[model samples]
Target: MRSLLLLILVAAIIGGIFFAIPYFRAHPLGQSTNPGATPTINTTATALPATGIGTIKAPDGESIGISDGTVAFATGGPGGSAKMQAADKLKAGDTVSAQSLWHSALTSDSGDAESLIYLEDQHVLNAHVTSNTPYVTIVVATMMTGDNASVGNDNLQGAYVAQKEFNNSSQLAGGTLVRLLVANSGNDKLYADTVAQQIVLLAKADPTFVGVMGWPFSSRAEVAINTLAKAHIPMVSQTASDDALTGASPYFFRVAPANKRQAVLGAKYAEQSLHAKTAVAFVDPSDPYSQSLERYFAQQFTADGNKILATEQYTVGQKGHAALPQLLQNAESKKPDIIYFSGYAADIGVLLSNLPTSGQFATLPILGGDALYELNYPSSARAGFKHLHFTAFAYPDEWDVQNLQSQKPKF
Candidate 1:
């Protein structure tokens, strides 16, 4: 019985993909802070046969598919002669310089390479494969929308790093091909279902499809998890923090500790550190992650004898402060010591920015859940803000994780 040793690091950041979104600093500037790291958890599992044979195409031509033989990003084509030379060098065994050249080509303002996206860096995953070697397969299913798929693009870049790391690790991987596939599960239920279904089919046909990596948020993960559950293939996530995913499925595993754990931590802090007796929750009904975290935090806090002041719900598009007056009024009545928010960083930022405007309400410490972890700080903070607290699973500095994909035979 080969048990798969799966490991995940607890942090707001995942691997090379780091985002600085919104969240108030609940802890002091230095409270044994961790920039975050994902541990390389171990699982003793039998190696299943895997190879690249079947196609996992997306619907409506809205996917990022790049075979080894193919070059460049899906959104852009491969570059010029110099780029090809750099590509050749990278293939020939020089990564640092070749990657540097590739970076230069991407950075160039001159007509340079038209098939290159300035923000994307997944070419390493698309490196050519000329061998007939058996390989291990991993898929990264992330988003490709929302402002040029900003978050998704970063995750894609991170996957490329994984591919590179796997390819280069000497002791870790003796000599085996690590094939990587990418799918765009654009923040939706049905759409994610379609992409996930394809992954299942791919796993069925291609025995090498060992596991999957993304489906970033809880909503997307909900569909993907169900689809992959049928195949019994595992998925390791860095940032999706829905309490439902906590040991819910054998096929679903997370590197970061779930939101329930985070909520409990917050509750402990409220009871001892802040000495809070009352609390309220701000939830986004549209987001699975937000709702789950909010519920878990409130439950823990209430269990600790904290009064449930009020729980207010809202949608994603609704700005943070749109209902501030009423929320303030409720807070005033309950007079909670800490205000809790559970949602995306963007929405949370709005509330954090506007909290100071509500007189006495501003003085009360505002506490938030893990949705507070992400990059978008410049936009999240208001001009005149005092203090806000947010929780996170991990920090990037805590882990030295890498991604690498190869096409070599196993030793």
Candidate 2:
């Protein structure tokens, strides 16, 4: 009787642990600060003054409104000002100072409400306004483009729309915005390097450019990040996913999650959830992004006791590679449970068209890296790729909207 009771107790404890694990993983108890979203503002603006600082604390629900030293700040609920209460009494050359949080002057009507008062590196506004239409510059290389039928149009179009919305909205730190200068990289790796170098030089010659927005492919981004680093220009990358690019330089930051991070997660999923017995890796011999991730995935999957049936290489952009037949035959021989491809969507599409319709791979699960997410996947071909899953490290539109909803006014 005691033995049976002990067994029951052990079973109950194991069941409790299994149920609790999911909840703990799903919801973290606390949130950390997003340094990028949070702005630090110190109102103390002086060229060279004794003590070099002055601190001012406004009343609760009131912001330290500083413009040309004439105080005409709106006092209301945290970040509820309908329009800026302009202090026209102050003019250029006059100095204004305050200490408070820097709220999103762009999308948020909560003017400087949630911004923390970090006193370091405070500055006086340039006070020089531009009457000319503001132009936003986008930088990229042709390696970022899509192929026929699914020609990467969706991604490029989405980026263009997002940029237009950002510039036209009331959130602009400067004045009215206008044209978008898209600098193209001619699909050549060498050209990508040159394009990046020219962008920085051009920005220095023109002062109107506020910030840049692209470098779609990770290879192009690898080259561009270094040039933009020296320029000290703020840029937001739309699609670059190389893990090394994160915090690569002071000026480098990505709108998309690092690619390797997503790959690691996929690796874990394959091991723990899918219980994959064997994995076959197919990588583009020419493409750096595909090759790097393929190598990394193979190392990880092998470490997990999952047998790597084979590591095959295919040259990118070359039509009708002889490797497909070998790949199918290998799949039949090894019967790998999982097949991972780190190559362009077009290449994968072609390979899928030629893959053997019988046996092992007919039912084998297919996995891929970020290159698969290119918008060019043919709609008709979507069903053919029923077994395909691609990894992308990015916050979908829903996550951004949730962030907006949860935002609190710092005032």
Winning candidate number (TM-score): 1
lDDT of 2 by residue, 100-145 (tens): 2223221454212111111111121221233434333333222322
- My TM-score estimates for the predictions, one after another, are 0.64, 0.58
- Report residue 324 deviation for candidate 1 (angstroms): 6.4
| lDDT of every predicted structure (CA atoms) | 0.54, 0.47
Judge candidate 1 against the unseen true structure and give its global Cα lDDT, from 0 to 1.
Answer: 0.54
Q: Over 4 Å off in model 2, which ranges?
A: 1-152, 174-178, 233-235, 319-322, 378-380, 394-411
lDDT of 1 at 231: 51
Candidate 2 displacement at residue 148 in angstroms: 8.6
